[model samples]
Target: MLISAEGRTYRQEAVAAAVIGYRFGASKVRVSIEAWLPDNRRRDVDNLLKAPLDALCHAGIYEDDSQIVELSIRRAGLDKANPRLEITLEAA
Candidate 1:
């Protein structure tokens, strides 16, 4: 969460939108995710997408997460040094 000087706490979706400089407004969406993990430990991919999807909504890429009609996720292998997530969002 990011707190504004005005005392508004920005969500991860809003922060990511501001950082990536992208926005969308579509009735339906498809998302592809690549998660680079720090270790080989197993985790649920669905758990990791909530914040990002929320961020997309905050960025006005869509009116709400319910617009996301398709979703895909995959492990992009290990990144012991700098784990990160890569996402691709498509609207229809």
Candidate 2:
């Protein structure tokens, strides 16, 4: 699939952050994602998964996205002042 420039930038930034964060070895992991939307617009939480997951994998956070044994995503209301995602990765 073709990634737009914005998507590419997001992935790049995610990868950079992952590099600065923790890294887990090849093991089962649980991922929790809390998304703060920029506005009170309809958005599917699932839609937010792929890029960050792929970016984390690309950054070598773990072996691969397949290693994610459990995943959780939730919309934590609007944060127009600072829209962002808070991701937590831990051994499953």
Q: Top model by lDDT, which number?
A: 2
Cα lDDT of model 2 by residue, 1-92, tens digit: 88999989988998878777878879999999999999987888899999889888878888788889999999887889999999998998
1-92, model 1: which lDDT tens digit per residue?
Answer: 76454423436535654565545665688889899999988799778887766666766667788887889999999999988788787765
Under the 3 Å rule for N, CA and C atoms, how many clashes does model 2 have?
A: 0
Candidate 2 global Cα RMSD = 1.2
Q: How many clashing pairs per prediction, in order? A: 2, 0
Leading candidate by TM-score: 2
Candidate 2 clashes between residue pairs 3 or more apart in a chain or in different chains:
none
Off by over 4 Å in 2: none
**C-alpha lDDT of all candidate models, in order:** 0.74, 0.88
Off by over 4 Å in 1: 1-20
